[model samples]
Target: MNIQDLRYFHELVNLKSYTKTAEKFGVSQPTITAAVKRLENKLGTTFLIRDQSHKSIIITRVGMQFDEHVQSILNELRIAEEEIKQNESATIPFGLPPIIGRNYFPTLVPTLLDKGILHRLNVIENGSYDLYHLLLDGHINFSMLGLTKVNPEPGIRLKIIKHYPMNIIVSKKHPLAHKKAISFKEIANENFIGLSSDYIHTRALDRMLKQSKISINTIYRSPDVMVVKSLVAQNLGISYLTTLSITKHDDVVSIPLLDANQPEFILAAATRENHIMTAKEEELWDILTK
Candidate 1:
């Protein structure tokens, strides 16, 4: 019936347990029960059914229909809060890829902080897929991601910051290191240190390799780009990686791919489509793109 009651309902549906919801909200179980009961009474409909055997609550069809509206209301509340904060002071909560955060942003962070227009800045290092979801969910105001192509979401705007080429990385002592370019077929039989299957980069590589009738003999899998680079440096395996990932490494050698002509990945910055940018964020975007 009220915002707090709706929030309680939403949390209960999400957690699927009144006790867990009570714990999360720091409220008594009876208080949570009372809230839900009052909401149900006001709505004149049964929104949830308890599965006694599993001790879990299940949303009914009517609940499912109402949930969409509830989510929209929550989103609006979040936007309202964000706008109020924006009016008081300018801040940009940005997200960046782990590789970028480690290698590039340290120098820029101090300068941005010194600018003084930046009231607050939050930087998170995460994978590109996770970054995409964070941007879509309004958890981050902006994100820098490595993607092959731009697929615009309904309320998102994207700017391609750079195009990094793909390269085959191997130990300096490896035979392919001397080559100007190596073909997929040449590395097909080589032991490969690769990104994990969940990563977007891995999916793109898999699609390309599948088309070439080549499969990497993956000997190691990791989410960390640095880990894959280190394994290649140890002569354990060869890996297909971006130039950005390999250019600074001294232990490994990178050779351009002979057959793969497309850009390895496009590093992009994205923000909400219609959102107003703070001056600091706008300046940061300019610096990144330039």
Candidate 2:
């Protein structure tokens, strides 16, 4: 009935000898016998049968069935104990988009180490759609993603950390890089490297391009923002990317799209609405947002 009784029962089945089980558990043989007897009494079923010649123990038919359940219970208890240990050790499972994880997380990693907070960071380079799915399924604790108009489900929350404008990125040697600002219409015929269709930025870019009657000859589609930038630098194609994506790259020049109607990317922190963030995560969030 109790965890101790279950543990005794599980060990008794494994060792197949009450004397051996007691020795392993640092208890007397009589104590093991009494505990197993008590468990059998509570369940109204005998768990073991004694061999007449050697006085060894053999599991009864009923005990075989109960053993499976007891093993499951013991396994669950072990998992619970492990989870508590991990929590006590200050290990947190965090999820983030790869771009953000690689670019910005390095700044906070040492800070977390200094505080003795260990992070099991889950990096996913997939677009926002996959990240949202992972968060909703409780596979990830939190994510930073491009802002979209979709509403979060109940118990999920979102905070706008910063507004990022989408910029047209080109290699310094590219002709369009000379223009301080270029209209979408001007670049309509240009070859483009773009985010995959699932990305919000990609959708936004497609919408703006459509409205301007601009047709992009998309040469590459990727989820990695760095890849997009690198390809552009090679003069393979030009692409539109958020300022965050190009912040560290000097070889690429990001020119603002001149149209007043051009859409801006909003970088937001997303978490379960009612779920609490650890003190360290909250601190990191504050520092990053500031």
Candidate 3:
């Protein structure tokens, strides 16, 4: 009957447990029960049927119809609120990839705030592929993604910040540290550390190595960039990463690889096709692209 009741109804139907819905929303089970009972009483119909013997809850046809209507109402309300917020303030739903390279822009959040470019920045940090989809679906206003010249996703307009050249990194104490560069074959017999396949860079490398028939013996794999870098710094194993990820480490040295497909990734700021930028969004974009 009320917005709270509709919200409770939505959650209860999806969660399928009155107790869970109550706990999630910080209300008592009795409150939830009473709310649903009131809604049923107000509508003069039962929305859910509870099997007393089996302790199961089931939605009736009427309940399903009501749910559909409620879903539309809630979705429209949410979209309207989002639009209003975007108009009032630059509510940019931005995406950041998990890679640590080329001084990625999430580090510039404070600067964005300082420049009055973002009234509020909703930043989502995830893998590049996921970020790309988030942009495509309009869940985010813009994203910085790992891109390549081949097979780029459709409906994304991007400005390439820089090319992330995939290179080899080793501890300064390692035997190959003094070498200028080495081919992928030279490290074939060495213990290697690799990023997990969840990463776009790792996927690119895997595909490139597979095509080149190059096999790497990875002793360890990690998803954390800092962890991989730390492992290499400790001389645990050698790893590959973009030059942008390199930091001034006392014990680590990054070198180029002679592989034909360095799988060098491009870091770019992406927006949906034909998207009109808000003044604040334009300012932020300029900061990133410039």
Best by lDDT: 3
Candidate 2 residue runs with Cα over 4 Å from true position: 1-91, 118-125, 148-151, 276-290
Q: Across residues 85-152, which tens digit of lDDT does each residue of candidate 2 receive?
A: 54565654455666566655676677666655544443555567778776665555567777545467
Worst 10 residues of 1 by lDDT: 110-119
TM-score preference between candidates 2 and 3, better one: 3
Whole-model Cα lDDT of every candidate shown, in order: 0.78, 0.75, 0.79
Q: By TM-score, who's the top model here?
A: 1
lDDT of 3 by residue, 1-290 (tens): 68788889889899989889999999998888888888899999999998888876899999989999998778656655665666666468878776732356657667887987655677788878888876765577778887655455666788887887878899988999999988877777778888877677688767667766778888998878788889899999998887777767536899888777567778788886646677778888888787
Where does the lowest 10-residue lDDT sum fall in candidate 3? 100-109
- lDDT score at residue 265, model 1, on the 0-100 scale: 76
Clashing pairs in 3: none
Task: After superposing candidate 1 on the true structure, give the runs of residues whose Cα lies further than 4 Å from its correct spot.
Answer: 8-63, 79-91, 102-120, 196-199, 260-263
For candidate 2, the lDDT comes to: 0.75
Candidates 1 and 3 compared by lDDT, better number: 3
lDDT tens digits by residue: candidate 1, 224-284: 8888888888899888777777656459998887775454677787888757776677787
